[model samples]
Target: MALQARALYDFQSENVGEISVREDEVLTVYSEHDIEGWLEGVNSRGERGLFPASYVQILRAAAGGGAAGEPPASRYANVPSVPPPQPQVAAAGGGGGPGVGSTFCPPPHHLQAAGGGGGGGGGGLVQLTALQHQASGSGGDDDDWDDDWDDNSTVADEPLSGSGSGGGGGMRFSPELDGPGRYRVSTGAGGGRAGAAAASSSAAASSSSSSKSTATVSRNLNRFSTFVKSGGEAFILGEAAGFVKDGDRICVVGGPHGPEWQEDPYPFSCSIDEPTKQTKFKGIKSYISYRLVPSHTQSPVNRRYKHFDWLYGRLVEKFPVISVPHIPEKQATGRFEEDFISKRKKGLILWMNHMTSHPVLARCDAFQHFLTCNDEKAWKQGKRKAERDDMVGGNFFLTLSTPPTPLDLQEVESRVDGFKGFTKRMDESVFQLSHTANEFARKQMVGFKKEYQKVGTSFRLLSQAFEMDQQVFSVGLNRAIAFTGDAYDAIGELFAEQPKQDIDPIVDLLALYQGHLTNFPDIIHVQKGALTKVKESQRHVEEGKMEPQQADGVRERCDTISFATLAEIHHFHTIRVSDFKTQMQHFLQQQIQFYQKVTQKLEEALQKYDGV
Candidate 1:
């Protein structure tokens, strides 16, 4: 791949001297001196340089930087120096460089630029010169110093049979210097020949260890190997057809890494307290601790991990509804990809977006490993059924979902569109809308019925008491007339002489009626009794036990009248009684015609309604 420089003076410390890598090779710069050790002082090429106040600030932002215009006030210690008045880049269409005449801004100022998605630049082993070593020693290299010094103290090269230690019990060094160019050195512990042998042996041992221990330039080669068998022998798998039984490397893309990548590739483990011995499968040997690294192309496009974390966390805190439980686990080892798919891993949506960028990965067997969780669930159900029928309480076997596989970005795009389509379908579905409306209407009706019963019971009891009072009123009026006939007759005769005074009999009768109505124990007792029932009924309803039958009983006892209907009737009664008294005033008119006519009507109406 062709390389491009990110900044004008991308520098690296090679064995010779500082090398300026400009627009020719992949390069990246770090503000921290320690990164030089890790990257071996290499850099990458891109159109813009993203500035961060501190090394961690830039890294954290790059891991998942916030959306554009978002303030990084807390993570960034220093304010960003904006480029001299240039238009901000739109998030879309490769983040590119500023317009012409723009002066470069320093730390805390982040730049959005276009860069070729070339692999990481070679940060090969650091060439340790004596001067640089003393000034730039990583804490890890301290032990190397002790070991090298110890090696120079050996005395003899005579092999001691089992151990590398010499009979002299000390380190040996061959001291020699080439003429003119190399510095002159000397050996004092043993003979020159023995010192040479010791030095050679030591060199060999160092070479072996360096190969095994020294951090290599992690190759851009993305390979994945899947063990398979063909013709009854072992075979290796690839993105294309399965090959004959020879083990070889197969390249594949990886997923995103969280902010703290150096801490550990996989921080979440299957178990912490439990030993590896407890985690087992019938056929697998050793374990694979999976780590997700973003594909080079996708890294520049989507929101970074750190940004997503911030967004997700902020949303969860602000809106409780977003805090859904049972989110899919990030790490699950020894599990097939198919199993993961069948489990309906929530991340499938995100993973699909990642898959579209790398077409070569579309054919990888690793992709096949991810089992759509739906399929795995169905398979488990089937296996469980068989086990139940056999009644053996024995285990059942089936293939697991595919392993942790990189998704196709194109497929991810399609899946997202599909999800949107599904949501629209649900919204437009007539059955769903109708069902929801029906449920709402049903709940409203239930509430109305409950309220009706509550008020209806009180009215029913009151109506019953009113009817009893009317019956007693008629009986008492008759008895009073029967016992006080002489006095009532005397008053009636005197009132008749002066026709305008006829209202006396009516007023006297009403006064007597009022005395009994005011002191009736029945009215007070019924009102108190109905109130107690109201309280009890409320308790029942609150406890989820109120019933329609109870309401019906209240209605029946109150004469089959609803509360509203009874209220209308009670209002009419009040009007009718008031009108009757007002009309009785006509009986006391100066004209005998009014007095005689009203008296005649009252006697007829009273006799006509005697049974009621």
Candidate 2:
């Protein structure tokens, strides 16, 4: 895809060599290894090298690309742009790039953004006219938006995975608001104007019928300008104003979630004296020891492996969309060592980071219950149930009614192919998972004593996660397929003489969900087949029905499948939640276009009938 340098940039990397790009200089985009915050492009002089992905705005998307579309999203990270800078026409559509797939490939040097997507949507879902043509896109390739797990990226990161906030600085709107390349407002609207007055005084994104009507246009522009300004009231007016925080200020002060850590009780001291001869097995003795430091009048609550394990399960059940960071692994040994306790403490910190990072998980009363609940028995009985609300992950930070900037139609399609590619990988993942389970069913059955219980629980959790993934992919894929078809059908109504555009937003939202669906039927379809092979292999080994050579072959096959499954799961977990977030952002951009169009249409009607 073609891109214009929004700013002057000169880059030299050991991998790609020296290349200088001037502001407004148009160049062809090749690849966006955007996770590392760079772009791959060739200047008009044929000098090709890695340059800052943030330094360019996608003037034109190529035939296929990866990542978020250009237009109508983050202003600093140019994912989406405002409609025409005029009519404010809502562009409700997505999935316009090539179907890029992810691979476990080595990193390319001199990180730079890649190219793809052209003019508009390729498999454009929205066509409002008689001969509706699919919009071209900036081009998406066959690559999926990769997760940052294996990537020890030296550059700044984007929020989530694919279709990050766009800047060519390529970023997204995130809660942390502190990542590199993320945009913020230390100041407000132009000239550091206050929210209300600036909006009242200025005109933005306005249109005029004639030069004589510029003043009227200015007034309308100001009305719209109010919403787009940095730190404007429009962004924060609707934050559940009546909802006060659940606990007292003193409650959250001690850890990453808050400061102060003064109130809650953490296990202070746990020690086991060296064994003295007190057992039948002579010379073996066991005794419990603890020296409690006195501070509060409140009684101390000592938690153990079971309590932590149970809490982990509860977190997994409720926050399926968020990845729970690994807890310190359960060990039969060191149950009472100071070093072990310190390790557990570190694990708790990591766990807290995971829980607190997500908006929904952070606010969970159950999470609070786990951290601050005094009596383990009473809390488990009374407070431990899934906080499974459908409203989880709602963008409360954003004004629900406000529309996002509309993205170009083509850029949207390129994104679809990217999602589809990810699904394909998921399909492979599922087959591998099924195989691993069946292949290892025998080894898993032969019990390793003493630690068997813990091992068994770990396996159960992994299996549950695998099943959960399959369910997520299957459900999302089916719904997406249906909704996308419906969205396509909805487009026909746009051509009606009296357009019933109410369906546009619905269609746009549907398309948005469809684009991000993680299911791949190709792999889903093969699930049964893969499992059958594994069970067969296991059966052959168990019954001794196969020769030694054949048994070895079966084991080898299972081993290969198991390895692939592990890799696939790693990739899947790393970015699935991020993809959901990305999809939602893109959807809002489409909805913004939908709202603007409807608002304009309504206003035009009011003008004609003098309704105002």
Candidate 3:
């Protein structure tokens, strides 16, 4: 029988692998996590996920098959029996409540129950405090940096019970208006599901909090918010631009020729170098930090792989149509090794290069802040501003200045469909190329090296045989044979070294494009979705359910998306040509150099046997 436990406090699911459990809910404990203070269990409803070990009281131990040896009840005896806090709801068409950092108010029914014992239900809102482990050292600017963006602790094999805040209570979940049963968890106050009208105001309020408080409540909200509501239109958070009022409207600004990119005023690049091993909290936690220096600023800032991951997520959220390249994969094991760190730093460099080159992405406020911010206070301020950015999803189109001349919807649809097919084929081709290149690199390192070594070994053995002869003529032949053997051995080392120069760079470039290819389809879909909405609006107009003016507004929005997408597609093509041309040139040059060295060594070996 599975060990059973009862939840003492309401637990909310924050990340992908966690499950939410209400107070008093029974759970079947599957196993304890490698990280202490967490347990893998299935709740009463059969939903399985990782929850805090502290939240549940184990009624029976699996070994004893009865009550736990230690009284579990006493452990949580002092814990409050209050219900979880209900997130503040924004009134429809009005500004939302204060930032998520503000103290949450309990539900009306819970309040009634607390006041009088007869009216409301049993559940009451309780404040769940996350485990906080203060880093050991003089409190300084380092203390203000929030490093909980990624849950790396779960990867450890040893249970870290005493380690500060292994993984609980940073992200919070609140009930969404779409469904009574559905819950929405926001990494920041601006990203939360609230009244659309109040999104910008709420973000401003959220930014007003102190740096430390902002760091504690906010995280990276990197996902696209494209959920379709009961209404035919797509759901969008309130406008991100503070200047744009609730009722303000926008029009396309370019000429009939189509949308063109405004030249980037600040064209600059960034370098990622010096991946240093860093530790905190008296060495309980350790991570690798990269030195980042932007060409525009010349000042260097230290960032971690997680920081790049967070920045990548922000770029994705901020620009849905733009193809954001993925950073290197996160490795759980051997992360601190030199090879892993070097590869990661190189990937970051490439990713940053692309960010700097793009006119639109280069000018992004969040990105600028990431590249330049060195002060702790400024970092938090920039983070909040990025999180609260309202110009995402459908609203992102609102920020674009499209060609004033209306686009032919049919032509736009055709172009979008063609690009969609291109991305699909490109994704498959890149995957195949990446796989083949990796295999070829592996063979060069192992198979080719071994083959050359085998030949060298045979030559050396022949030299030994020649050495046995006492004749003067045999002496020269023996020396030549040994020299040839040494040359072959050197060739074997060259084969092992060759892949790093040519094949690895090709594979890395392919991997980057593969990430871009993956992003393109979604971006195209977003454009196509807008077209679909336009078609729907036209149908409604035909049926007289919607006015012509409303349909026109829909058409304008659709046109905006089309123009932006077309411009981005053009940009992608241009960049693809330039990147492939440069990379292939370098790849071919390296390949030639590798082969020339091999031939040069063989020629020298041939000269050694000239007399023989």
Best by lDDT: 3
Between candidates 1 and 2, which one is better according to lDDT?
Answer: 2
lDDT of 3 by residue, 260-315 (tens): 45546558988887789989879988878889899888999987776676677667
Compute the lDDT of residue 95 as modeled in candidate 3. Answer: 24
For model 3, the superposed segments whose C-alpha errors exceed 4 Å read 1-258
lDDT of 1 by residue, 456-548 (tens): 455445444454665654654443333233333333343344422343333333332232233222222222222333344335445544432
Q: Is candidate 2 or candidate 3 better by TM-score?
A: 3
Global lDDT of model 1: 0.25
Best by TM-score: 3
Distance from true location, Cα of 247 in model 2, Å:
9.8
Ranked by TM-score from best down, the candidates are 3, 2, 1
TM-score of each: 0.17, 0.23, 0.62
Using lDDT, rank the candidates from best to worst.
Answer: 3, 2, 1
Candidate 1 off by > 4 Å: 1-28, 31-416, 424-450, 458-462, 469-612
* CA deviation > 4 Å runs, candidate 2: 4-7, 14-24, 30-40, 45-50, 57-366, 372-612
Global lDDT of each model? Answer: 0.25, 0.31, 0.57
